[model samples]
Target: MTNPTNLTPSAFTGARRVATALAIGVLTGLAQAGALEVLVLDKEGKPVPDAVVIVVPSGLGVAKNPPPMAAVVNQEKMQFLPPVSVVALGAKVRFSNNDAWDHHVRLTAPGTAVSANPASAEGMSLRLEGKTAGKPAYSAVLTMDKPGATGAVLLGCFIHGSMSGHVYVADSPWTVKTEANGIAVLEDVPEGSATAKVWHAAQVVDKTPQTLVVGSTPAKLTLQLDVVPKRRRG
Candidate 1:
């Protein structure tokens, strides 16, 4: 992934699109361009059924209709609106606080991962922007140059220590959150044979990586993870 830790918004976006597109194209070529099987689990070998899993081709391919303009993460009840988030490497992440109280949101500890570019952090903050419902939202955009998983982005408020959530940046559209049954299927992976990786926010980093090959018909990959609690409303 290309890292734009120091570039301005316009420069960063242009650089990111080119880098991500090229990488996706390469991987798409190497891959049969078929469906992929994804499995999620915890450190204890139990099924992590509800986590989000995504697969970005190690290289670039034909870009899908660019996704919607931007996605959002909200702050409500002193917690992040959604505990889990997924985005393409060059997409925008908007942060909006809908709670009755004010919260300070910042990315104190950026994630670390190997990227095609070595001069900048693959992950960075556009800025510490804030938002409120009934008002305009605040946002920042980050780009990743390589296709791989990352640690976690730590979001916190000096006013509310418990407010937190995870942001996942993927290189491909092959990403999905698992159902309650602990299964997530990545449709249209390169057919034939390839390796697939599973990730979760509630467990150790990439604790369970599975490999599978797609055939003429769709493929089914089943996985398990240790049990964990989903987000609940108070």
Candidate 2:
């Protein structure tokens, strides 16, 4: 059992680090296995990868939750892997450090998304900032925590200001992180109008949730969004 004293402010920051580190590395395949095709496009009509698309039942048909899936935001050589991740709400996220040096992880409340490169209409990106509240829960080894308190969690290491990552926890279980090809497959959805929300750290969140129909023909959504240059993996 965790001691109450360890839950103090200073100790909380330490505990939070361990929590984030364990769940930071395993987001590449975290989307639900599906067949409804999800296509994302830039203003010029190119596939935009790394953009997460969420679908919630619009009462058109019954929607069921998949098995609980945990996620990771791992630290390695001072870089966060996958860079971006999508998860169902109330999902456990583990944060682990695999680097030779110790690192401090921090999170902020959800921020509104705005244009990062209004003229540059290509690439995957998001520039988010939230009103930070409370000290981070930290620990020595690896630790685990859920992204239940925030809309989107922005991660950065205090020790290494340059290192960063984004974890998007969706309110619904039906979410897909677009692949390199900018395709998110959502399957078994009830045919009719379902609400779809687009998430990008850099783009403005002015998009009105669009209605999507998951019928015999796959639903293809073309979103004209401003883009940022692609991210370089460390």
Candidate 3:
């Protein structure tokens, strides 16, 4: 290394310029991204959990946490373990029956009329046998590859009409599910304008998406559904 005391004036100026450029670059990168906090509420003004929140940035910003490409939904206590799930488009979802009794997995597009024969529905169908002692639970996997199946798909069991759930196939990587506090936090979102959309199982009709601006500072938004969702069974 060169002697510090013998450094020339030009050398010091060059070092200063390099340092300034690096500092500016870091600040610019930080300013280009931000975190968005979204809160979902029902028509009754109660915090809504399990809601799907999607942020479509105007600039092609990459998601720090993309939706999962695969997920598992379990059948337990005569109900789907997770009543709602958010997955990336073309995701493969596994349906596992943990109960001692057999269960059928019926998937159909939202707004599709319930058919007398669920097996004959337009979407896919599978029958999962009940789990047996000393053996793993019966499970089946289905790929949501259909082009038209980009949104929420209704999940049910023909044997048990009371069984209901949903699988939301997200088109954007910035999709997230609201937590128990009814908040969905999206990090590293590109700064600028973005369209925020909220989807709930109870909202049969889609709500209008809201437009907002994201900046270096954290941003908060609140979206409310038109209908109150029913509480899930414990």
Candidate 4:
């Protein structure tokens, strides 16, 4: 369920992205790739599910796709499956009501795009001047004004107040949602050093980037997070 407070559009005001597609492609094509295993735990060291983990190389750029990576959120039995979704910025999302009755999906969040043109990928410039700085790109939400779009929106059934779900729009291609076991595996990482980031709807921070190094063998990382859940709304 999505709490009405704590997470709003104004959050991610300091976030930015650039040349995201090329960066993901290059990282995908790395010759010597390794796996990055992530373990997420709460401040109490309890497993936290649905947390997002993203890795950005030290000298690469980040960008979001137009449709938010074709992510889908389904409503069945008056509940949302995969309760939380993670998508890249500018990605497109789909909402479906599988319940017998009708349900309305709404997403409320502040969204902005730094790309020269939100719709034109060619028009999207990194301002990198052909430099691979490997700086971590920040993320902000994007409104779903078009059909089948999803970003930072509060999805709910106007009729069923108990129904709630959320979608996260991120900037990096290396992002994944933590499973129930608090585990996430990032594969094909080039053997080198990179920056690791954790993002969730409940927790916000000024800066908390960790260093990750991928080598011939797989690496394991345990991340501690606070379970500051927002109160349920009526």
lDDT of 1 at 40: 61
Tens-digit lDDT track of model 1 for 59-152? 3333343233356778776787667666665455677766555666555324464432225344333333445557765544444333453334
Q: Between the candidate structures 2 and 3, which one is better when assessed by TM-score?
A: 3
- What are the lDDT figures for the candidates, one per model? 0.57, 0.59, 0.86, 0.58
Question: Which segments of candidate 4 are over 4 A away from where they belong?
Answer: 1-31, 59-68, 110-153, 204-207, 228-234
Alpha-carbon TM-score of each model against the true structure: 0.61, 0.64, 0.83, 0.61
Q: 43 in model 1: Cα distance from truth in Å?
A: 7.2
* Residue range 119-143, candidate 3, lDDT tens digits: 4447767799999988999998887
Q: Which candidate comes out best when scored by lDDT?
A: 3
All candidates: CA RMSD (Å): 13.7, 18.4, 5.7, 21.0
Evaluated at residue 155, the lDDT of candidate 2 is: 68
Pairwise TM-score winner, candidates 2 and 4: 2
Structural RMSD, model 4: 21.0
Tell me the lDDT of candidate 1. Answer: 0.57
Q: Pick out the ten consecutive residues of candidate 3 with the lowest summed lDDT.
A: 112-121
Q: Higher-TM-score candidate among 1 and 2?
A: 2
Model 3: residues >4 Å from true position, as ranges?
A: 1-31, 112-121
